[model samples]
Target: MATTTNDTTYTESELEAEKTAGSRSALAMARRGAFYLSLGLAAAMTVLFLPDLLALLVMGWTAEAGAELGIHRLHVMGIAAVVGAFLLGLFVQAYKPRERIASMWGAFLVILTASVGTVWFGVGRPEEVLPFLAVTGIALVAHPAGRRLLRRGNSYSPALLGLVAVAAIPILAFAATQLSMSSSTVDPHALDGHYVMMTALLIAPIAYGLFAALGFDGWRLASWFAALPIAYYGLLSIAFPAQVGSTGAMWGVAAICWAIAFVAVAEYSRTETSSMLRREVGHSS
Candidate 1:
């Protein structure tokens, strides 16, 4: 009879403990979601206002409120906010992830996939030579053969490190091409998108590469800066397609980058929570 009572008491205690743990976990997730939502709002507000603020300053200098310059024309600014939110989200949410260099697969995959799409679309054009080179360079880094070279003790295998460096050359050149605004110089498309493509496509990939190479420290803020702005920019391309240059391709890159980063961040959070639970179990045992 005593043993039966003791067993019931222990079972009740276990249930209570589980309930507490579950509550804590749910609260933590809720708090995290709220924080990201707040950051998203902040980003959106900044994008909506900052450019107009700049325009206000310019107007102060010239004393002209040109019809072309106003807060309402903040399509790119909205996109910038998404970039901020995305970057900051990663830093906060990716508190703990798998230690393996394999965690960076998403980082390299980002550029690799985009470059492949570019090559596929522009294969016959002489202008696509740079993107073609970039496709080769990125493929070397993202392919399984390159990842297989990563050693157990090393942060990055020598071969993988070397490939990343070699890959940088072509990628950098491709980014330069994206930012050169040549399309605008000849056809005037830059003014329409306001370098949204430059920030999202050209800058974010480089930031991710740096983040991965640096072992995800010291360069986090940069990664955030590269990421968060693209959401709004990507939206603009979809909503106002006629206004954005290379609209379809640019949208694809933005979507893929955002999705990959989000998945990485979520994985990090899940791993962290699992580790915490394990530690707690160990302590109790």
Candidate 2:
């Protein structure tokens, strides 16, 4: 009886170990899938949208378009900035799938919401929306599943929390502005310039802030966010005063954004260097 019982116990242990190993293998596969999907989507979006930015750049330089066209160019640039921020998040999620699982969520939500909104509103071709919907849906499932398998703890730094708080100002203001614009019965699609501005005002801060809060890199997005307003609203306003008028309030907000960007970059660099040094030390030891 005792010998029989020992044999059964050994068999059960072996089965349990194999089950755990198989689960880990599955999670690894899911994580890789999430990474490739996120990156491929980013590349696809860039390919899709790069033409718009390039066309605007060519027109601005070759034609020497006046204030009317100049403002339009700024609008295109703002839209590019927002897209760039989303791409950055995707890149982070791709490179560090485990560490930035939340980033994958952010990227997935952005694409899914945009896709659904476009389809529902008849603003985009139904066929065109299918790819985005399919990719994000797969990621939404894979990323969270993989993250659950890893079961990592969340840590929030004080500085990054502060950054989120600062970013909320613009985000909230942008939301209110969007509501006001909608109330006025203005056609959002017809005015690309205003659409891009409001979109940037809402998207950049929220996306980057979420990234920072989740312990992913925030500096790149922060720099992009700050650069748009500073370059388009502050500096370009001087060159094309009639088209992009300089307002005291705009400049003030731009300055604040610049400060936030600088701090984020500095903090990220410091932490990254420290981590690299620690890895080297561990390897040496």
Candidate 3:
């Protein structure tokens, strides 16, 4: 009776172990399948939209020609179509969270198409037009998607910070030019000092975020340092709008700073989550 009982107990243990292994194998397969599906959807959406995008460009050209002949109607339908695709993808992804990346990629492609359409419709130096389109397109597409991707524990901090810097540089350069022009006649000292200070404040978060993303503890500490100056200036502007000269420009700078800070925080959170997971694994082992 004892021998028989031992055999039965061993058989049950083996079955349970086999079941656990099968479950793990099934889960891994599901993860791989999800990844492939997302990639395929992204690619298929890009291909399907290409022809419509081309048609939009052609329509934009027609509209531009018509405007020259005193017939003024905007070829905004193409723009609407492109925007609609993005909206549709967004909604679909909202309902199906697993497909978020695929949807974001789809929306990005639509934005790229619309940017091309804009260049085709607008009467400007193609060189000038393309750069503007590319910059704006990249910023608008990247910010929200980058935010989402980073939130998913993905290591997009470096790229996200780079995008913010790219978006900010042009604005900072334009602000500097405007400040220079205004300073030529007005008391240049006060304005110049404020401009320099604000520019540094704006760039500080970006630098810190980049450093943190690159795995530097000091960079993480520096982000807190950067935030204080930004907050101080932000409050000062609110209190003394006249002193700031351009509330709009200051607000824009503040927004960029906040974006940088948010990215830093998200990256830190990801690091902590990884650390916790590692600790749990060590304990289990």
Q: How high is the lDDT of residue 32 in model 3?
A: 49
Of 2 and 3, the candidate ranking higher by lDDT: 2
Q: Per-residue error at 2 for model 1, in Å?
A: 81
**Model 2 spans > 4 angstroms off:** 1-13, 54-71, 101-137, 148-155, 182-197, 214-249, 252-285
Top lDDT prediction, candidate number? 2
Give each prediction's root-mean-square deviation over alpha carbons: 18.2, 7.3, 17.3
For 1-285, candidate 3 gives per-residue lDDT tens digits of 122344554466677787899997786666545544543554454456444543543454464543552211121222223333444443343333342443333334434443443343332134432443343343334333334543322233444354446645754674465334433335443222333223333444344344334333233333343344344434434533444333544674665466555546654555654432112212322
**Between prediction 2 and prediction 3, which has the larger TM-score?**
2
Q: What is the C-alpha lDDT of each candidate?
A: 0.39, 0.48, 0.41
The residue-by-residue lDDT of candidate 2 on 1-285, one tens digit each, is 122344554466677787899998897787666757656874686678465554543454344554446555544444444444445555665554555554554555455544544443444344544575576666556663453523323343344545556656855665455434433234643233344243443455455445444344333343343334333333343434444223345654564565456455535744664432112212322
**What is the C-alpha local distance difference test score of candidate 3?**
0.41
| Residue pairs in clash, model 3 | none
Residue 207 lDDT in model 1? 42
Where in model 3 is the C-alpha error above 4 Å? 1-163, 166-175, 182-192, 246-285
